[model samples]
Target: MSSLQSVTDDTFDEVVLKSDLPVLVDFWADWCGPCKMLAPVLEQLAAEQEGKLTIVKLNADENQEIARRYDVMGLPTLNLYKNGEVVKQLVGAKPKRLIEKEIAEYL
Candidate 1:
């Protein structure tokens, strides 16, 4: 099973935008309660969807440039990127099944 990877502003381009596999970029911050709540669900999804998708966490506080670029206004925002563009965006903490369902078309 694959584990979620952390990406910084400097690495976001190479790690996510250039990745061959679709990426689920979770935009979060340390003090956000919902972000904490969604962490485990993301971990499970990351493991289950290993080859099909890559799950990465980006700290909004630390990677403000990337966050602003993506227009992330909320914590725990999930942006699914394909071919270097955002294919879907899900805001707030969501259940694993719902998250999966939301991105099912991409998968």
Candidate 2:
């Protein structure tokens, strides 16, 4: 089982936006290659960061409304939500180290 939680448009607000911990929302699609590449890295981070951060996956294809609301134009786009707002955005498949470094401050 993966540590990452799956969030749909219906649960998105309560799960990610209203989360107590910082939320890393991964916007991805089934056919996105880079999204597949980044999944394991995110899973690892979700496990390692446990209490410090909350990581969730949102299918951009299935939940196009939320994706468009957030202006996600690419696959594997990581949007860090803090206090119901996006604080940082990473728009590609990146190494775990790079991902960590990018969102370190927010974590």
Candidate 3:
């Protein structure tokens, strides 16, 4: 199983923009409470989706350049990308099913 991967400004292109499967990127920062809440949900999804999807984490604080490029307005913004372009964006903490539903179109 490909565990959830991390994307940095330097590696975003290779990991996310070029991924074969739809990529779910969780943009978070260390000090954000909602980001903390969403982290475990992402972890569970990472394991559940093992081969069906790709999950990546990007630290908003550390990867400000990438975050700016994507226009992340807030912490814990979940962006769904397919073929190098963003298809959907979800903000704040949400249930796993809701997140799964948001990406259903991509699947």
Candidate 4:
């Protein structure tokens, strides 16, 4: 029933870092309001850009090491990884158009 594909500490490398397409990771927590706000936008992006990009969500609370490794100080931090490295970092909730424009650069 979930709209977005959820990633965890276990699958971080396999799903995000090693992905063939550009990966957009939403690092968030269950209790964060902004994280919840970004959910719909991420889902829409995932649905629209299925072949162009891979969208993954990582729970900050549950995946502490992954969040800390990325230095995710805020909730709803969207990180884009390409070829095993982070190429972009977007913090806070943003509109769909803005996010799509940013992601389009890598595609």
Candidate 5:
């Protein structure tokens, strides 16, 4: 099935903002092509970085509030949260190496 965990506006704070491990929240929508393309990359990251990081997916269409609060202006935005604040923000579908490089410091 799905490798990535799904989070909503209600669980956003507890599951992501308050998480002990760094959280990567993917802000996306079903209709977005780039979002779909990035899903597999996210799944790979979640599998490879298990204990080091927590990966959560938020459907922008379903959780507009959280998306808006985080200033998610585009599809497939990946926001890394640490200590209840955003530490890194990556947008669009990128290669795994590039994505990892961007988040390397956080990990």
Candidate 6:
């Protein structure tokens, strides 16, 4: 099973905003090819960074409210949240090393 947790519109605030550790929210859609490409990388990240970072996926199509609230304009948009606020945003598909480098400080 995938290590990544999925967040829905209903549980977004409680699961992500209220999280104790830094939360990496993957805003993606089922039809997005790049999002599919990044899934495995995120799964690896979720497993490797367990307890240090909370990585969750939010389907942009199914959860439009959260996506718009966060101003997600692209697929596979990675938003890092700390203290209930967005700290960093990464758009598009990227390699695991690059993704790790981008969110290294937060972790």
Between candidates 2 and 4, the lDDT winner: 2
Q: What pairs collide in candidate 2?
A: none
After superposition, candidate 3 runs with Cα above 4 Å error? 1-3
Put down candidate 6 lDDT per residue, 1-107, tens digits, no spaces. 35578999999999999999999999988899999999999998888999999999998999999999999999989999999999999999999999899999987
- Model 3, 18-95: lDDT tens per residue? 999989999988899898888888989888887788889998899999999999989889999999999999989999
What's the TM-score of every candidate structure?
Answer: 0.96, 0.96, 0.93, 0.95, 0.97, 0.96
Q: Give a tens-digit lDDT track for model 2, residues 1-107.
A: 34578999899999998899999999998899999999999999998999999999999999998999999998989999999999999999999999999999988
Please write out the lDDT profile of model 4 over residues 1-107, one tens digit for every residue: 35788898898999899888999999988898888888988888899889989898898999998999999999889999999899999999999999987878897
lDDT of 5 by residue, 34-100 (tens): 9888888889998999999999999999999999898899988999999999999999998999999
Between candidates 3 and 6, name the one with more favorable lDDT: 6
The lDDT per prediction is: 0.93, 0.93, 0.89, 0.89, 0.92, 0.93
In Å, residue 70's CA in model 2 sits off its true spot by 0.6
User: What is the Cα-based lDDT of residue 61 in candidate 6?
Assistant: 95
Please estimate how well model 6 matches the true structure, expressed as its whole-model Cα lDDT: 0.93
| Model 1 lDDT-worst window of ten | 1-10
RMSD, one per candidate, in order: 2.0, 1.1, 2.3, 1.0, 0.8, 1.0
Q: Per model, state how many residue pairs clash.
A: 0, 0, 0, 0, 0, 0
Show where candidate 1 strays beyond 4 Å.
Answer: 1-3
Summarize candidate 1's per-residue lDDT along 14-89 as a digit string, tens digits: 9999999999999988899999989999999998998999999999999999999999999889999999999999
Backbone clash pairs in model 6 (N, Cα, C under 3 Å; residues 3+ apart or in different chains), count: 0
lDDT of 5 at 76: 89
